[model samples]
Target chain A: MARVLTIGEPMGLMVATEPKALKDVTTFRRYVCGAEVNFAVGMSRLGHETAYISRVGNDPFGQHILDFLAEQHISTDYVTLDDVNRTGMQLKAKTLEGDPEVVNFRRFTAFSYMEPSVVDTVQWESYDHLHVTGIPPALSETCRETSIAMMKAAKAHGVQVSFDTNLRPALWPSEDVMRKNINYLASLADIVLPGLGEGKILTGFETPEEIADFYLKQGAKAVIVKLGTKGAYVKTTDETFYAPAYIVENVVDTVGAGDGFAVGTISGRLEGLSWSEAVRRGAAIGALQVQVESDNEGLPTLEQLVAYQNSAKLSE
Target chain B: MARVLTIGEPMGLMVATEPKALKDVTTFRRYVCGAEVNFAVGMSRLGHETAYISRVGNDPFGQHILDFLAEQHISTDYVTLDDVNRTGMQLKAKTLEGDPEVVNFRRFTAFSYMEPSVVDTVQWESYDHLHVTGIPPALSETCRETSIAMMKAAKAHGVQVSFDTNLRPALWPSEDVMRKNINYLASLADIVLPGLGEGKILTGFETPEEIADFYLKQGAKAVIVKLGTKGAYVKTTDETFYAPAYIVENVVDTVGAGDGFAVGTISGRLEGLSWSEAVRRGAAIGALQVQVESDNEGLPTLEQLVAYQNSAKLSE
Candidate 1:
């Protein structure tokens, strides 16, 4: 099993419990969520030894996130309890159709104030792979430095790195800065994962092939493009292929599909699967994730994945 | 001027910004509100020297409440910060009419877990009066004990006490227990304030006169029943009076109308106004409170109260 470390911010989420507008609804259910944490939980559920590294406030919400991570069997050795700022929070409105409206209140939060010194303390050599996202670097200058420090440390320790361009425009000062910083971090990873839409914005590439070639030319060994329901496109140097998406009757939520795709591709690669097989696993997991409500609840175990793959082939 | 001290749990309120349900709302505005805090703010704004006593989490929401109280000139001398528990919070829905729907998340909160020791530190003799609501004692056994202790301390020190039967049925274990405990606390006060509905439930009386006599027999010097838009009913030993509510073009919210009445009656009495004039002021303030959106925003200053009373009289 691969020992994976994922770094980013986890926030307390207040999701509307009904189908009414946020203003008209009176009930909310709390949950813990973050892109990197979601990826860690997905990887851990697939039998990978995953660790989550982040900082949270010394408050109840922070305690909740820590408890949730522990329950998911993700190591919390590198998590820090910061008293200077409160943990971040997000309020999600559950719409009848379309993506849920999310209002984030994370400015000057404990996670945004994370220091590079915290990153320097982690034992990078113990991890086989490291996963990072664009959200943390957009939080604050301190968080940006911490993200770079973590990526550089993992690279120095010979740990493979996976970078997801999960772009958030509102968190950063300017689009120029976001583009510059995210591109710099992408160049540091061995595997660069970006959705087709994010790839078009980040690389100014109109097609999947051009987008894959753009990231691969920038020191990345491979580029995987998430194409929503169509599937995932994997390109590694001289080879390129498409993995068709599994057919599902219902799509409960599509918020975490990309994260699930990343989990499948990274864990499959770690398990010595071929590039096309890894992309197929990514497509399968992405299809599964969209069928569930929460961000990471539908992630599959080893047996579930194998069964799902065989069933998909039989249906075809 | 009479120095007033009000005690209760202050919660961070997340209010939806639009007319949508809680599930469909994309934006929320944060505010610090609680019955006692609203009363304190009202009294302070009306030029009374007001102090507030409670426990809150050592978090940002708690900090916001403290800063807001300070800005309103309410003393925070007896406020305690607890690290072990989180501050209370409530999600309020915006309805087109009547009262709004509120979902409370206050279980095991810092204020609910407050110890009686915090109450013992307050210098009761320095304040001319103490104000409390039914919400705090219903929160937990510890809060109940603390409420009883503070009332007893105020009584022993010869400071007048105002008790508002701000009953929240969801906070109590049973209606019988709430009636028993709230009645016991009411007996310890010189002035008892109860809404017509709450009075009917607590005293088992159908009319304002019978309700006033019920509390008057329990050692209370005066009883005032809030009669909604109709006005206020006040009764003392041998005298009874009804003050008519002022007419307003719009009724923005009714959540804090009862608290506004308390502030008016108590502060008017402290200023040596006649019993009838105090009741009239209470009715006037109650009328004003229903014309604003926030809990205490419509609470008027001394000059504003005079102007409103004059305009109301001119209209009549």
Candidate 2:
């Protein structure tokens, strides 16, 4: 099995227990989640060796997240506790219509204080794949430097790099800065993934083909464009095609669909699948992810994925 | 020492950790507080036997509040756990410019479901005073009926009734309902306490004496109007006077000043202090309460109160 290492922030989520405005909600169920952590968890469940690195506060919420990661079998060798800054938290108001409304309380958190010294001592040679996201670099200037240090170390070790353009505009100083920094990171990744909406903003491209071409021209080996339920557009130096979606009968939540897709794509590649076949796996995982309430609950195991694929072929 | 029984909702409070807007804050320090509970806690600290009656959700926050009250030596004999509905919570954003912005998440909570049946079993005769507030009656139709039932039982037992017009306009269905219900409750109480602002809205009286006369005509034995740092105005059938405030150089928080005043007034009356002397005690507590950062942290014990009064005399 291939080993993948991801670095980002994990926040304590307080999800509303009922369908109401946040101001009217009195109860919440707590959970630990983040885009990169969700990706790592999805990979680990598929029998891949996954590791996560981040800083958490010396608080109960921090302890909870660490315990959750350990239970999920994600290695926490580089994880550390921060005494001065507390962990970040989010309040999500559950709704009957559309997506839930979320209020993020992540400013001045332990994750934002990540410094270059964190990655300087890491043994990058042990990890086969370095997975990163756009969020970490946007947290703070020091975190930006740390992200570059980690990516440069992975590159020096000749490891494959995968980057997800999970853009959060509120975390950045400006759209211009985010675009410049995200494009720089995407250029460094062998496989670059961006949602259709994020592509349009970052590359000024209106279509999936154009967006993929923009990233490919920047020296990326392949670019995959996420198109929600319509599926994904995959492009390499020599080929390009669209992967159709697996139609889900019930969509309970759509929070971590992209992370599931990333997990499938990365793991499928490590298992020696062709680029087009990997994109198909990504599409299937994304479809499965939206069928469950909790963010990453519907992410499939190896047996579950094979069973699901076989059933879909039979129905077809 | 006299016995005081208070019945109302207790809430889990999430106070922001720094000076910031509600949307910007990411950390909160949790506390348990309520209007009647605050009054009861204040009385309990003064060596009075205080009992609280309410319904709390069978949840961690509810349990925490119960444990906190027990630690403070307030009897929770009549408190029951609600199986279905959860306890209420409020988020307070810390600020340096003014009173913190608060958002209530108390709708459809256990306290709102308190019925007349809760009051039916209470031994109202054993209590020397029944402390109630305008807030509980405004929660739900059942709570309104419960408040009336409690006041009627206290009247039947010849127990002194202390009612605070702790106005929360948003909790009521309409202003008319709140005004009518509050006025009716005030007429039934031996002591009616209203802040100057609440009195203006409830009675449309321009001055404290006029406000006191309005309550006195409605069969109230005494009326006390809180006039902030200017002190309190007290009026009985035969006498009326203004108790000037003790000048405090620093005012950290003013959220629970009125609750402190009620505590001092109720306890002072129990201690056989004259009406004017009780009003002075009310003013002293109000002055002291605003000198601390926490909501009710500045509320003092009897010895502390005596020491404070002596110091104020020396300073003057």
Q: Candidate 2 regions off by >4 Å?
A: A1-316, B313-316
Candidate 1, B180: how far from true, in Å? 0.5
TM-score of chain B of each: 0.97, 0.96
Worst window of 10 by summed lDDT in candidate 1 chain B: B20-29
User: What DockQ, between 0 and 1, does each candidate earn?
Assistant: 0.04, 0.03
Weakest ten-residue segment in model 1 chain A by summed lDDT? A20-29
Binned by DockQ into CAPRI classes (incorrect, acceptable, medium, high), candidate 2 is incorrect
Interface RMSD of 1: 10.8
Task: List model 2 lDDT by residue over B1-316, tens digit each.
Answer: 9999999999877766677654345456667768888898889989999999999986655777788889889999999998767777666666663466776656677888898998877888679999999999988999999999999899999899999999999777778888888999898898999999999889988999899999999999999998887788899887888878788776666777899999999999999999878878877887787776556678898899988887873122
Every candidate's TM-score, chain A alone: 0.96, 0.96
What TM-score, to 2 decimals, does candidate 2 have? Answer: 0.57
Tell me the tens digit of each residue's lDDT in model 2 across A98-133.
466776556667899999898776778788998999
How does chain A of candidate 2 score by TM-score against the true chain A? 0.96
TM-score for each of the candidates: 0.59, 0.57
| Candidate 2 overall lDDT versus native | 0.83
Q: How many clashing residue pairs appear in each of the predictions shown?
A: 14, 0
